[model samples]
Target: MCAMKYGLLFFVTLMATNLVSEADGDLMSMIDYRYFRCVMKREWKCPDSEINFFMYTPEHPRKHFIDPRYPKLLHDFGWDPMRKNVLIIHGFNGTYSKSPMTFIRDAYLSRKDYNVFMVDWSELTRFPCYLSALSNMKKAAQCTAQLYSAITQAGALAKMITCVGHSLGAHICGMISNHLTEKQYKIVGLDPGRPLVSAYGSRQFRLGRDDAHVVHVLHTNAGFLGESGLVGHADFCFNGGQKQPGCKGHIMRIARCSHFMSSCYFAASVRRSRRLVGIPCDTSCPKERGYWGINPQRRAVVLGDDVPDGSRGMFCISFENTEDCPFD
Candidate 1:
């Protein structure tokens, strides 16, 4: 009787294994082969120590670490409830100390007396681990949501806060809403990561129009490293949304350079609002010869920080001179 029981247990375990394999096969058919290879292979749950928040004020340009568990530490670290808050999240392989997203932080600080928070989850989403990084985004977003909650509870108005993110960081900003009772006011998604995300990620896992009152997406390297077409309430396709003129290299190298340029362009716009203007386009970046023929009747909209909250549509803009474009 004991032998029979052991045999039955072994058979049950084999069936369970087969069931998991069948489910995995179905998922693989839905996503890219590269993503299938790494999908949930090494899922990660980031600890509070691995995710960190830093606050920067105009008076104190230096960043001060703030723990969400200790909400009072926000005031101790020079967080001002009266001032508008800007939360900047970095992409894969990025840290609060240094990254292209820092340009946006610097721009906000220089332009106005605002409280800036940098969300760093670099240890969980380090380079060469894109798959694991994708898996860890939800945990990172959950931890950051706690920081956002603490800020609002400490008297910072939700309407006065804006979340700015680049690449995978963009999706993290959106996912924060999943943990909140109310939605965010504004979200600037700079070149939201494409790859496996754009193809397989659902709205809950990616940046969407409903994530915030105003979701502005700027595409600098669309269809390659960045998500193409409209992914937000307002989508701006700079230089056709595929490649920036100033970025010079082979295809992949240029795409990387273009991806980084989104932050640079946003920084420039914060400093000089309404300068980088765009006009309504049919979801496609217009060629140089065809750009002039676009309907002049369409009202032009400003790109970046000052974009009106109610704005919606796909817009395209090109630099008459490459020198005007910002490059990192």
Candidate 2:
């Protein structure tokens, strides 16, 4: 009887093991699809903690970049009969065609007053701040080119335009300023993450007065950069920084999977431009107080091919942008 019981337990264990193996196989396949490109893989690793270890080092954009998930974001946005211009950008690990962006799409669609557009960049996950700042510089230039083409095509005539970015998307906000024409602009950067400043120091990157008129950076983490120093984005602030009053943590937040309902805040603010949305600004930090990095002249972060020769980006190459680029 004892031997029979032992044999029965062993049989059950083997069956369980087989089932787990099958489940793991399914998971692994999904992983392949999920981490489709370097940009997605890298930027998604969040909270900047040791726990977020790099699963695989992604190949550069020129390498194995694949399909851009944000199709609507890249579309030529020309309103019927024309309206004001508005460009919306996504941050790290974000796709304009995906989740939060879906909410964004709906938000803009609801408001017919603005000629809505989106900037689908090189995968945000692929370029670290240091690398992204440099490589994305040109991509930024090209995207702005596209936006202008879009603006021209739509034939929209308005006083000024506005650009909104989230986290990594905020970096694109800076990039647009660097590459585009100097227009009276309104850039709202929500929870702009520190552009993955490298070991040497933080990069001197910011949306200059040249890009947008009043560029506001709403900060969440009170790390190195205080309330000042963010050039281009003249209005540097915080979402009350860290744990603010109105936010209701992860699950309960308005929409999407983001820890904070950042997009909702972004949309709310975008809807009510010119007027203060009152979305919690950290006025506590003394104004005009921002710490500088090591080499201010050269941005502290290197990006794209400029991602320091030695430094390897976190995600591996899955495909190339040219292979799947939905461009003319």
Which candidate achieves the best TM-score against the true structure?
A: 1
Model 2 lDDT tens row, 1-328: 9999977754543332222111113323433433333331233321222111010011111111111222233222223433455566665434555555445545555565554555555343332222333334345434454455444444444344566666546655655555445553566665554423222223435444445555555443333221223333223233333333343334222111222234544443444421322222222321233421112233222111112222211111111111110100
> Could you estimate the TM-score for every candidate?
0.82, 0.50
lDDT comparing candidate 1 with the true structure: 0.76
lDDT of 1 at 326: 34
Segments of candidate 1 deviating more than 4 angstroms: 1-47, 285-295, 320-328
| Full-model lDDT, candidate 2 | 0.38
CA lDDT of each candidate? 0.76, 0.38
131-249 in candidate 1: lDDT tens per residue? Answer: 66777889889889998988897888899898999988999999999989999988999888877786568889999999998899999888777888788988888887777877775
Clashing pairs in 1: none
Q: Lowest lDDT 10-mer window, candidate 1?
A: 16-25
Angstrom error at residue 175, model 2: 2.1
